[model samples]
Target: MMTHWIKSNSTVFGKYLFVKGLSQKVNSKKFEVGKTVFQSLNGRDLLSFEGYTRNEVYSLLWVATELKNVQQSLRLGKRVGLIWSNPIAKASLTHASQNLESSLCCVHENQLFGSSNNYEMLGRSLASTSDIIFLDVPSWSQSNVEEFAAGSNRPVILISSRDLSPAVVYSELLSFYETYGFLRRVILVYLGPGNNPALNTYFTVFPTIGGHLRYVVDGVIESQASWEKGLRLATKFNTEIKQFEKVDEAIDRAHAISTCSHNLSHMHLKLKDVKEMDLDWTFVQSDSHKGLSVSKDLMKAAGHSLIHEVINNQSWIFQACIAAHTSDYRPIIQPPRFEGVD
Candidate 1:
């Protein structure tokens, strides 16, 4: 009957064969009448198998099951930090950082540091401590790595999206720090003039990736598609703001602006000054500017990728640590933090 079952259900039999291949000691001369049953017996086919003892088979199965559970638990509770250089990268990281925090049931912190323009500030921040840090800056210099490993005992993970040059990517990852630093303030300024007070105020302080300053103004009047895009962006922005320490203000602003009706034209007009402003100097503007020429889909894809990298990279780090330790044991690492110079 078992032979007939194996013949009829080839797929299941194939899986069994694959598992059997994981072992090396299959006795070819055992139980000719019940060969299939003997093969099906656990641990009998494993390379580690000595002789097919029923007790050993049960123990092997229990060990395998326990190991699987341990892996799952490790993945579900890993903490991570994400830091970025540019606005697009920041947005992507923000989207990703939030998702990872939720999926891993871990804490995710976002950071933004000036690179090229203010390498000193960037160095100071990245050189701080973090359990895991993802650098999304376009250009990375050697000094950056030295600073990253300056004070913390945490691991710094670097990520460069395809949009960045390879040279820059290499420089960023190579920059290491002993400790990771946290950004003090991430201000989001809304630069659009609208009858909807809610929209203006809500965008003004919406959190961006890397906890840097984000300025969202009216770029252009929203088409049907643009309106939908804006809604999605707003939804993400709203969700993350709730996780911030001072969430009550964000919640109040969101509630106040929820009832207001506005168009994309108003947003564009409000944000127009952003493009024209000289980014070389620190100047605050309340007007909108010409936004990025990319399509909404491209922007959304970037955001999705950013989130995946943040989550998966942490998982990779955890796996690497596990692999390094032969035992099925995990070490508890503290969250990375920046230690300011005394």
Candidate 2:
């Protein structure tokens, strides 16, 4: 039998070197953090969250949050091209793009990644036509992402949930942290026994921003794997990894709780289990299909406590708009206060 993989680090081998090389290449072309958000983010591929500084992440959240404040058609004349595998990802992004008044030319993963050498031609054509591109293939790894990025000149946002390379899709978590000012205790709950690589993004990000993140695991194997992963991440980030055996206990300590149970529509959170948490405790249902992990009634009870209530598909919209220079307004980026809980 193959040995079970147990440890988690911020990046896979050579990923750091690859990102550094890309950064240097971009810098050679006069690519640096620009005065405005549009200039700063334009013509970049967000393959992974590995190279982003805490300030950059915070600035992005600020930009995305600010995009929702205005009713103006920011992306009116711009066209967005999306290559997506996940149906939920495609639908969520389509909805968000429509709301922003951007025209979309979408290609399914089967059409783009099929057995054909025309990927380069297709990518070039798409890049020429679209202002920005979104790649949401969950199966694509770091190398796959890099290859796509290299083929296209337009900005590429990798929004997939993959093991080898984590996406910036979870930056909505940081946006929540910023919007709430700060939350001392945060709980990340996954419904099933299998390991969700999406959580790796959260593990890497929360530490950089400085916050208490606790993981709640149900299965014995999962708990062990999670504990080992947490240790490795803590060592890598020089922070503490708080793992809890009981969901209710974790919920009790958490000021905010987010769930990543995508397909577990049958599994629901019981009211009695979470009744002890403060009335103001925040709940985030991160899945595109709402109420898959938590019941609709419990979410109703959450009331004002529920945040990012819908799957935040709009982050991609703001990112595309920034890259395409669709907005003229340059909002100030303010850093959030960093706090670590004991």
Among all candidates shown, the one with the greatest TM-score: 2
User: Global lDDT for candidate 2?
Assistant: 0.52
Q: Candidate 2: deviation at residue 158, Å?
A: 1.4
lDDT of 1 at 221: 22
Task: Give stretches of model 2 more than 4 Å off.
Answer: 1-39, 70-76, 86-88, 95-101, 116-122, 164-171, 183-194, 218-238, 262-268, 276-280, 304-308, 312-329, 332-342
Which digits, one per residue and each the tens of the lDDT, describe model 2 over residues 1-342? 011122232222321211212211111121122222323544556665566655555555555555555445654556878887766667766766676677778888766645654545666778898877777776655566676677777777777635422343445554455556552234344343335555555556654544446655444332233334433444444443455556655555456666665544334575554565544455665443443576555766734334343345345444434433333445444423323222
lDDT of 1 by residue, 190-241 (tens): 2332222223222222221112222233333222222222223333333122
TM-score of each: 0.23, 0.68
Worst 10 residues of 2 by lDDT: 23-32
Number of the top-ranking candidate, with lDDT as the measure: 2
TM-score of candidate 1 relative to the true fold: 0.23
